[model samples]
Target chain A: MTVTSSVPGAVPPPSTEVGPRIEPRIALSIRDLTKRYGSVAAIDRLSLDIASGEFLSLLGPSGSGKSTILMAIAGFVDPDGGDILLDGQPVGGLPPEKRGFGVVFQGYALFPHMTVRGNIAYPLKLRGIRGAELDRRVERAIDLVHLQAFAARMPRQLSGGQQQRVALARALVFDPAVVLLDEPLSALDKKLRAELQFELKSLHQRLGTTFVNVTHDQEEAMTMSDRIVILRDGRVQQTGTPDALYNTPATRFVADFLGRANFLDGVAGSVSGGCLTIDIDGASVRHRLRDGEPRMGRTALLALRPERLSVLAPDAAVGDRNRVEGRVVTSAFVGSQHIHVVETPLGVLEAHTPAFGAGVLRKPGEAVALAWPWDGGVLVEDR
Target chain B: MAKRPLSGEPYVGFLLPATLLVCGLFLIPIGQLVALSFGGLEAPTLRWYEQVAATDSIHRILLTTFRIVGLTTVIAVVLGYAVAYAMAHMGERQRLALLLCVLVPFWLSVLVRALAWLILLRNNGIVNEALLGSGLIAAPLPLVRNELGVVIGMVHYLVPYAVFPIFATMRGLDGRLMMAARSVGASPFRTFTDVYLPLTLPALFGAGLLVFVFGLGFFVTPAILGGGRVVMLSEYVSISVLQTLRWGLAAALSVVLLVATLALIAIVSRVTGVRRMLGAS
Candidate 1:
């Protein structure tokens, strides 16, 4: 099934006069929603707008309220106080079935008594689609998930990955306006999760339907989401494009959560034209601000990525940018790269450098200089 | 795996008593029952079988027994499912309170409970008194000495047994399955029918069968509540053996009742997995 939107009386005049309208419509809008179970808040005041046909991932650790947000939007858990709008209309009081959203739970939750065909045909049966058309849609759905050979098999008879596919096909069979997946790939192995991640991304593209996925794995969010919202303790840490979150984090929590980050605490000495001069161990270092640069005399935490640092020669006058003198305490070869732990005055800093064809490796106690460019550092608030 | 040798002899000593009990006491009685059904000192004959089949009142009594059992089973199952569903979703204290309420009726002696129902449903009982005092009825209703009282007492006895199995099954079921169904465009009622009801079918069948079999052997409620008007199979058998001194006819009727109970149990087991349903209950 294909989804094509044709706005009446809004046609293009000519090829030169037409510009692209690439952004999809907003399918679900959540505004200031909060839900509490007992004394602990499961979902704090969180607002998010999911665009139509866009695959959005709510990535966090356990108890970070990713699943709570999904449940709130699905109308399973009523928020203590806020509203959820679907397609510009309020639907806070509606039940989950009235929300018209398909959900694939963590374990797939396929009816064990139903065959593959019967499981896929359940939603259609509920909508009163019977006889020939029902059979046709069921067959099409089974084919869509590539489960033609297992159509008559029970859910338990299929492998974990196969059950997950059947769940996806069943969720999409009835043409739901949006699909919410709750840790759908968690039960599968690593290779299967990676494979299904691409399949889910492509399925979103093929169906042109909005998708909201919840997962604790950050890499899965980075690999699949059009936009990623990282949550912690029932509050959203940050929400942005994957690259934006990776390069520029607003808080130390967001920086440490999304990827590996080495935080350096120092006093912001001065600020000049988007650059902060910080005094580190009696040496002045000017670091360029990626975003949210701290003010003068304020305590600042700088996030430096492991891949951005390099081991330089001790006596080499490197003009690249900020540099620190340290000794390589330990190093390990990791196939494609060598992960080195350099003992510096700041602390033990991790540096990853590509292993180029039998090159000279740094041993323990070898004197070296750790250098990273100014643009590689991000100034984050002390959170 | 091979058995590991312990520092003591294999448990031949523990098995001696149970084995001797089964072979002597249990087997002897059953063998005697079988022989007595065929014949006793008057030589082998079908006289008892003929006597049991000849009486038209015996046939009517047997029919009444089955009808009361079947009706009680149906009513218990429906009400038990409702109560069990409510219990499954209730808070811990509420669930405990409901469970206590269910057990109170079951814990009371069947005779005592039946007497209580008689007191409540009699012509000048609390129910009729209340209605008459309120000017709702001109005359008292025929409630205690009829089929309705028999069913009411039997269901009150059997509902706790029915509810425990069904509630156990419902509690073990994954609540997420219902949520999954609802999120897939199913209404609350549809989710119940397509998901919750199907998952709980085994418990329903098992509980229904248990109540039905227990109903078949019912004696106290019907004997007291039927007031000698609606005679059931157990009461009739008692009269044939105890009052009329007809051992042959009683033996024949007892054999028929045993066979019918066994046959019903076998059919129930086949449909709803008898061994699993009745295990340790």
Candidate 2:
């Protein structure tokens, strides 16, 4: 996406948001994007290609550079070294207004002075879209968010969810080629956040424009994104589909961040065929390695999901392979499942056992065997 | 207006002292002045009002006052907006320096400021001397003892009053709104005109009203700088009360000035809500 000099009058292609569903293409490309504040780097050498008509989320914790990347793409952050491309045209050094993007901010950023109808019509008005055409498009955008009833009301009079909808309508009313959302639902309460997430996802589906969202909420990213890019310390840790990242995380950070993970830090004992055995304290646990994975002999790490571990009776004969004995630290029924905290020789681990009809949960201090299938957890980078 | 006083009716007693103070110190004198403007308790007359409407000198004075105050308010608000914008966007040290520059002038006594302006703006003053020395002008120019001098002095004095309210509103504005405006395809100029300007308008209107109202009561700067030739309403009132001993005419003029100020507020409040205008004012 990088080019030598800035392109003067580089008009972005017209948005397909108003037309029939256009074919999905590469909508945005970030190449070696780097932004630093004195000594701290907010985004460091990060590159990502976002596809058109895809809900791509930048998922990371605070200070992990998720929001920074979104801001850079939105032309708010001037990168020290990098280029951003809109449909293969380098858009670096351009002012945000010339970049033609729709942004949904976390605080909603609704104009306190403008009513919902006026707020939605503002972008169109800027473009010289006037009269009945402007009104029609504004009403359509409002209808998209189901906000016709409150169209004339001011932004302050609306609730958080309604204000967020108005913000959404305002952003989409102009029909930009891409929309960048910065934790747009983070300010709302839990139930409202969930409801808005569904509404936002449905809206994205209906309008086939590219959506680049940034959020720290892992569940929000997983539930809404077509592709999730996990970031840590301003570096791309992993990027894949939701299930691909959840089922096969390349690093402990990814596994632990994307969902709950039980890390077994140990030393690699030996490799037999495709399986590598690791010594966890005194007991040994065998892990099946993936193709192209190098043979390991030093300290190794494995991330086992809690739901993958099955709870069994103390002296149950389920074969010792991939099995560990531990004393139950605590066991409780959470309506749908029985959660067991087991203190094993390696470390304390949790196993979410599916609850049967009135299943009796194991008591604390009682011995139990935790077993999993042969291909249970993935080998993650120890860090 | 609530079903019951949410704050409790007993707390209304806390306002008794302030209410008494306002009625005794402010309302009583204003009422007495209003009574004096009309002819006395028994023989009420509109003689002063008729004289005010008839006198050509009084009309000239009132017109001069309006023109000078109006021009000064416009200039002060414009300069105040520029200063507030700069202070809002500046770094800490620069902002502090700008703040001190504004505050230092505010702390100076009005008499001191007026006398100081007179000294600087007089015919053979530093400004005229510098211009003369630079060969920019053939004559020293009538820099003071004129209406322009009065406006210059008044703008310098009233700018600080205009700045603080606008500065407060500017500082409280969320940065994300600007970014949002830019993101929605508004050029920087368009953003300013469409969003930023409209949003700060309440404060701007409030500053204009403050500067205009404050300028109406301006006595020292105009009296000192105008050199008695450029007699504004306040100076006219002073001449009526002191030199001519025309108490009824002075009181009538005062009533007119108060009504004009109130009318300006009413006009602005009618357009923007009273609560909104007052909130920024």
Q: Whose TM-score is greatest here?
A: 2
**Model 2: DockQ against the native?**
0.73
TM-scores for chain A over all candidates = 0.89, 0.91
User: What TM-score do all the candidates reach, one by one?
Assistant: 0.86, 0.90
Note the DockQ of each predicted structure: 0.69, 0.73
lDDT of 2 by residue, A35-101 (tens): 9999998988777777778898889999999998888888998899989999989999889988988
- Residue A311 displacement in candidate 2 (angstroms): 3.2
Interface RMSD of 1: 0.9
Which candidate number has the best DockQ? Answer: 2
Model 1 chain A: which ten-residue window has the lowest total lDDT?
A12-21
Positional deviation of residue A8's Cα in model 2 after best superposition, in angstroms:
31
lDDT tens digits, residues B17-55, model 2? 899999999999999999999976689999999999999
Q: Extract clashing residue pairs from model 2.
A: none
The CA lDDT of each predicted structure is 0.82, 0.86
Q: After superposition, how far is residue A34 of candidate 2 from its true place, in Å?
A: 0.9
